[model samples]
Target chain A: MNTSENMKARLVDYIEAFNAADASRVVALFADNASVEDPVGTPLKEGKSEIETFYTYATTVGARLELMAPPRGSHGNSASISFRVHITGQDGRPAHIDVTDVMDFDAAGKILRMRAYWGADDYHVLADAS
Target chain B: MNTSENMKARLVDYIEAFNAADASRVVALFADNASVEDPVGTPLKEGKSEIETFYTYATTVGARLELMAPPRGSHGNSASISFRVHITGQDGRPAHIDVTDVMDFDAAGKILRMRAYWGADDYHVLADAS
Candidate 1:
């Protein structure tokens, strides 16, 4: 596959791993030195160890991601995936957070950098998917 | 209208003004001290004067934007619009660039910050729309 296709495939893998709560699989998709900055302006988590810890905590809550759109603008060694993450809120109610993750890849196709874009207001409590 | 609807309307106005090549209208949608970071990692253009200059140059080149999808995840005074920008290349060939612009708004519904996400490789020459 070409660069765009390869990167998109990696994105799919990342999302699937997240939905499956397979933190190891998610961490393995990144390069050892990869960095993740969720919400863009936040402090970044660097290296596989930190990334693993982050995902472990995230998946422990049974968070699941459902793609809202197919990956877009996948070109060069970068692409973005937009989705809604479903998780239980502190009140034991279902909440959905809209998120878009932009990723950059290394020559070997491992994610080198990932930035998720979403704000606090992006989260909402939903009654149902319908 | 609520915040999300207001932001989405502003996003539509921005795109319409861009397609119309109305630099002044585009600049007016932003606050006097607004900043634009096209491609996200580039040097930001601060203030309306600089913003107007940027749009003027962009429109002068006959750039046009077509929405590929309606604005997404518009909430809490922020939204993102994904589109295809049509421009002529230096070689006089037709080119299309895929772009997603994420915007943050002030209480007055003026754009406070705008970040466009796309890379050089996102530009592709097209034989036809099909």
Candidate 2:
């Protein structure tokens, strides 16, 4: 099992790598066969190849993450982070999505599965967006 | 599946009920066969009876929950909340545990499963606690 410290550290690294737009860096943290179920009800993104493609687009989109609290680690091989994803809304205005991501890690310290939680109502357009 | 609005409302109610030390109210929000894992990797308290016992003790202990962020809802029947649990530590000093709870709801809008994420290190003693 991965140590809690290790799991928490990796979660922080994930946010940093994603905000840097370094897709490869983000992908490297996952196991080759990791599965990602972003937004909970969506179909899974299985394996690194598909995972890489997903992150590549995500990172290129200019969305940035801002952590809401310290990352939490479980006594088990899981960790979670709550954050806001700043993005451009459909009307080309500034918006942010509230999200919480739970990740399970392998013995090798790579993420094995990741599930993100967010609903349509969680997206909010900035009131002062210019 | 329950709507996102309903799910989020229940999560908020959970916090309010727990803080009010109303164990029955908390248990009412759960299904008859609900399972609660207060800390991930710990044994689960299964069924409403066991869940009530668990919450009865938890609420009686004078612990209070403070939300760290707004509850997050998923596209599916799931929602999450990040919060701090204030309690008296082993040293008889005020401390807090950083926790993130992921709850899955049944079709009728009752919680079916709850998993709380918090490792040992997440428990912090307030430096100013007298």
Q: Which portions of model 1 show Cα errors greater than 4 Å? A: A74-76, A127-130, B1-13, B19-21, B27-80, B83-98, B102-130
Q: Which CAPRI tier for candidate 1?
A: incorrect
DockQ of each: 0.17, 0.87
Best by TM-score: 2
| Residue B119 error, candidate 1, Å | 7.3
Instruction: Give the CA lDDT, 0 to 100, for residue B113 in model 1.
Output: 93
Q: Which candidate ranks first by DockQ, i.e. highest?
A: 2
Once superposed on the true structure, which residue ranges of model 2 sit more than 4 Å away at CA? B128-130
How accurate locally is residue A18 in candidate 2, as Cα lDDT from 0 to 100? 100
Task: List fnat per candidate, in order.
Answer: 0.04, 0.76
DockQ of 2: 0.87
**Chain B TM per candidate, please?**
0.93, 0.96
Least well predicted 10-residue stretch by lDDT in candidate 2 chain A: A121-130
Go through the candidates in order and give the clash count of each.
0, 0
In candidate 1, chain A reaches a TM of 0.93
